[model samples]
Target: MTTLASVVSCLSDYDPNALPVAQAQAIMRDFVQPVSGVARVPVRSALDRVLAEDVLSSIDVPSHDNSAMDGFAFASAELASAAGEVSLRVIGTAYAGVAFDGAPTAGEAVRVMTGAVMPAGCDTVIPQEFTQGDANTVRFARDAVRAGDNRRLRGEDLARGSAALSAGRTLRPADIGLLASLGIAEVSVRRKLRVAFFSTGDELRSIGEPLDAGCVYDSNRYTLHAMLSRLGVELLDMGVVRDDPAALETAFRTAAENADAIITSGGVSVGEADFTKQMMAKLGDVTFWKIAMRPGRPMAFGRITSDGPNSQGAFLFGLPGNPVAVMVTFYHFVRGALLRMMGATDAGAPLVPAVSATPIRKRPGRTEYQRAIAALNDRGQLEVRLTGQQGSGVLRSMSEANCFVVLAHEQGHVNAGDTVQVLLFDGLV
Candidate 1:
């Protein structure tokens, strides 16, 4: 129920005409809320899903004290009186799945494989490699081991009734293994977010369509599909809508009715064919119409209500028409917004530090995301250089680059060998 006006009024330097990247990010964080849907799924199928509730361990992890390695287990008290080397009579051997039937007596030792239950009276273990042993006896220096060396205690990994995983955690592969270790068959997780996206512009055509004098194939939708797929969202590709007002309105309404979010890649800029802006204003609350960022200056954010009776409205992200602009804007804004809506506790990836390989000119008033390639130099330090062209329409630059060189708003120019922030796209996008 938080209104955009209420969120904006509280900011001291609010400016819709030239919104700073940090301020826009803050507004997004304040306005969007997590989805409330939850479902139970098998632990194997819960990877990447946000946990709905905390999972507490029902039993001790190891269930009992066990041997951590192949060694000789015995009481450590006898070592205190040893002169130089301590030797003990070999009683029996314990395998991983088996345990010694009885405790070893004083001056006696038992051979134990890794993961074997420690004998009842045993308090220490000397690794097999550290001891000179035969079938009947074991010999080692008195100072070879401490009292509790090579001993794993019960519940050392996960104690009973303790939280194994917390709510809002996006399950990783290691988390899945942890769940399996705890014998968890299923887990409650947030349902996948339903997102409907499309591109706008009469000049843009689908792949199979014939190209006219001024038309080009719409690459924005395909890029959106690839990025959204990586996010694991249920995507509804609405195809390409024209620049006409009626078409734009129909697209917006349909997306609002069927999706939790709507992403349109055109008609946000102040151009002659920008009917999407008008439709957005008419449909719902347009939070901000401009941002002080290069390649993606004009954008739109709204909470559009559908005509359907039970509709709660979908969050709208009207990105720029240019291919590179769409990508940069989506990463900087839409990606985090969608993660918040999906109930993920992760704050996204951190910016990595790297040295700039070449001098670059930049203005001081706006943030810039320059596509670049980064690699470790001969000195074992990360160095980054920009791709050929950084124009908004140069989709080739984005495809050829491995990371983005992020220049801050107040940052003016970069000299050669200057330290800059980089965000790698390997697993992030």
Candidate 2:
């Protein structure tokens, strides 16, 4: 097992205070281990699940040479010497699900539909639209097609006995379709990861509770539930834990025993009432970092263990209490970590580039994720503009934006027409 001490000792430039974003990410990558259990599930139930083994194709994709269009199939020798127009006698008709049994002579053509198996001795197909033909014969221009045109050869898409999909791949919709084409009915995939999360603070209240002078309804848990659901993880919500050491420790132990990972929002800052940091230090090997980033600077990461013989530990992440900070932290850090725990080997989210529609104020030492709207400009080029407010506590900024303009740590102020990097919230549908 990889411990926090081993990971920290390997870092030559490790600094808990003012750590860079890349450094923190490296630490996280070094500390995580993928889960090993696998379950056999139907292809439909394996959506978004990571593959446990390679899936090889049992047969060729097309299984035979097929016609790619609704046209007449004939030997290319008949049209080789024709100057203006070529004509051939129609011998038989071949539909998509049926094959032509008879081989066509040199001057004979077989009427073929799309996906029909290519008739014997036929190497080319002339689309129906390009030809003017009758029931007995078909005529087309000499240059309409070349030899071997519009013919889908066997195993063009996927060859038999080849790997159709590899292990550690997170299955998407297109992957499911590919599996169906390969006649794969069931797949061995990693089991869904279980994550236990909670909110900590005396000032936080549930939905039905009355709003006293200093208490506000908790929104972090609701957002966490939705985000975790999108990531396809089973959730164990522990509700709000008061700002007491005993209650906090109880929540931690319970979460450690039941979940593969524990997520807590609040009580990790440098405030005097924050007992979470102390309890976390006592319970396990945890590290508090002040990252060089915006909206999410303070975070705690480590693993925690419970007492007794039957105890099993869980990975821990302490997020900030602010509404937007919680989401930003989750997306940038916890999301990838959870995917790794689920045994997925997909690369991190890709960042797209677009022109900045307006100027942006930035510094050189800290990375920032500014909420922005990415849309096409008058020239049909992608451009991005910041939302109304960018305060860490304002959740509306995140809602109003479709993408986050990622300003790098070494980047300075951006001009109006400068290109900026962005991570989209929605991909192509």
TM-score for each predicted model, relative to the true structure:
0.95, 0.97
Candidate 1 per-residue lDDT, tens place, 84-202, comes to 89999999998888888998888899999999999989989999999996899999998899889999999999999999999989899999999999999999999999999999888
| TM-score of structure candidate 1 | 0.95
Clashing pairs in 2: none
The segments of candidate 2 whose C-alpha lies over 4 angstroms from its true place after superposition are 427-429
The deviation in Å at residue 117 for candidate 2 is: 0.7
Model 2 clash tally, residue pairs: 0
User: What local lDDT does model 2 show for residue 208?
Assistant: 96
Model 2 worst lDDT run, 10 consecutive residues: 420-429
**Model 1 misplaced stretches (Cα beyond 4 Å):** none
Instruction: Give me the overall lDDT of model 2.
Output: 0.91
